[model samples]
Target: MRTFDTDALECLAAIVEEGGFERAAVRLSVTQSAVSQRLRALEAQVGTVLLVRSRPVKPTSAGRLLIKHAMQMRLLRADLETDLQDLTPGAGALREEDRISIAINADSIATWALPALGPLVSEGLPLEIITDDQDFTHEWLREGQVLGCVTTLKQALRGCKVMPLGAMHYVAVASPAYAAENCPKGLTTHNFRQIPFIAFNRKDDLQTEFVSRACGLRRVALIQRFVPSVEGQVRAVLSGWGASVLPTLQVQSRLDSGELVNLAPDVTLPVNLYWHCWNLDSVVIDRLTAALTTAATQALKVPG
Candidate 1:
């Protein structure tokens, strides 16, 4: 097996992380040509192509392996620096941003996640947040893209610690006028099938799932509208495009104002969320976990 030098491996990892040779060069304070040469040398040493040379470059499987090692090395270096600092009297303690990266879903980020993260930000901790869909957030943890996440998955990934974040409450809602016109009686399993639905996107199935659970049916009205963002989804529902399942936090004001009516007051979907993070001993991760736990307790209702 050919031996890979530490510097070359680190360089390749930087290129992959930064997503381009030029950016990696800027990060490492080296010339673009120098970054290119190091990548070429590393690829030659490995006897395979490590990166796809395209706009916003992507890593090959071999490159991913090296990137993981590079991240581990970086963490180790950071720990060493912390140890050295500890030996000096009157040295300032390490800040949060210097220690962690987190991945979360957009709904959580927009609603409950930020409130939980306030303590960390107030303390000047360095945090990088990647917001995506709830269903797919765990993929970032699996790929080592983030050290922690708020995900819907219950199972813990290998080498990670998993804890329950809390359940998000959702209710089927429609504008008061629309509800009065279309729903003379309160919503039940039988009437839900006939109601036109507003979906966040083609990928969203919250309405469908609610209908399925409520009525034990699969077919919904073919006439559906798509609104992609959380705010847009709420607006579309409020505008009477169709009824949708919205988080209570997002639609609480409208509900209070009688602008939107709950389709079924008793019917709700509680999506249980989990926190997954690398199972490592780090003060930053611990602090984040504590903050999220406190926030979840206050914001999310316990599943019944």
Candidate 2:
């Protein structure tokens, strides 16, 4: 039987996670030279290069497999820790390497996901959250950078399980002042193109999709300003930067207070979200799934 060094494997993971050898050294409490040496030894043992040395270093395909293995081993350790704590209560604490990492969409994180995770965080679950657009979060899980993710993808990855968590309803909204000045007739076929729209990022298509659906057009385009955050987009809209498609749950207070107006009160865009996790018998995974699903059920609209 062939054996690989566990420390070396963890060094590779830390380097990739932290983005560089110096940062990885700081994370692992080792010297920078030591970090490099460990990585070299690991590559030699594996008989291939693992990482692409770039700014915010990226893993090669082989490195991804190794990273996934390392992360899975960490999950196993976390599971064992949970078992031990149940037996003795207030037992040994989890190390930094045992931190649970997951990817979630920025909108969900701003609205319901953080609150759902509060109990676990307060109880000492070392958690790392990677936020991205809902459509792209699945890539994090596919790359083995996260143990689980809340994403728009419905199909489960190989060796993964997926559960539908309903859908987030989005409404096109703008500041009352902006709406009155720019879109007095609300979002119509003629006015949508004239009114600027705030998009989360270049990757976001919700704004365009909403406009097309609302205007009964095959294709539509609007002037876009990127804000990159759910809360930031809301702030920009309130500042009269542009109109945006925002979560109804996130902007309900503003709407009620008349700070913002729904551009299409009768129309809403429903984005279906799902929870994906590895098909492993880990108590922590089960707990996370339960927490996310329960909160999503209450917070998100059931998709028709």
Candidate 3:
């Protein structure tokens, strides 16, 4: 069994965060040579090179594993300290909360997840939010890139626990002018041929998937605008650039105000969402989960 040195692991994490040994030394309040020696010690213990020495340091595969382990351990340690402080009636002062990273889909982050996480953010628990496709968020867990994530995958990673958040419903929408020029009446194979679509990115398959099912063909329309951000994609569609699929919750006001028309009245796509987090005992993680569940229950569709 490989025994990890706490100080050495902290040094490696700092180097990865600060991007170089010299910068890491500044952050850790140590000499540059000390940082180098600590990293060398960790590498010797692990029997592999953990970091790639470059302009901006990047972690090797082995390094990512250790970094993730160190992060989890650090959070647990913080939790322990908080608990100990709570036991004392009059603690010296307030404690600083530990930061955690969460990976989620762009639509989720834009629509509901961020709002659900807002209260915790206000409480001073900083979160590193990373946007990824729902289908691929689970891979982040396996790679140890995030502590938790909102994913569409039902299965949990070995050391993770999965909780069902709810379903996000999507509707095909377009600006009135775009619909009048293109899909004036309804979604059909013939009318959609020449119409353009605003996709979130190359990874965005919602528009194409809706088109395939609605048109009875697995082919996307010819014209395309790949706006990478959620707000940008909404703007692209709103500006009459193209029609696209958007979360119904996100466009309710616009749809009601006649800014956007529902191209397909009966057409809706439902994506079930789940929360996957590290299976560890921590008060902050538990509190976050409870808040997310409460918010999701109010905004999303619960399973029967």
Winner on lDDT (1 vs 2): 2
Of candidates 3 and 2, the better by lDDT: 2
Off by over 4 Å in 2: none
Model 2 scores a C-alpha lDDT of 0.91
Instruction: Tell me the lDDT of model 1 at 83.
Output: 56
By lDDT, the candidates rank as 2, 3, 1
CA-lDDT, candidates in order: 0.77, 0.91, 0.81
Candidates by TM-score, descending order: 2, 3, 1
Per-residue lDDT value at 286 in model 2: 96
lDDT by residue for model 1 (1-304), tens = 5557777876786676678888888877889999889988888888899888888888888887776666555555555545565587445554332344688876787688898888767654556788777888888778776778998899999999998877998888998888888876757765665678887777677777776666556665534687777888888877878788888877888889988998878778888888998888866677778988778888888745
lDDT of 3: 0.81
Each candidate's number of clashing pairs is: 3, 0, 0
lDDT of 2 by residue, 147-210 (tens): 9999999999888999999999899999999989998878887788788899999999999989
Compute each candidate's TM-score over C-alphas: 0.80, 0.98, 0.86
lDDT of 3 by residue, 92-188 (tens): 3223223476788998888888888898777556567878888888887777767788888998888989899999988888999888887778778
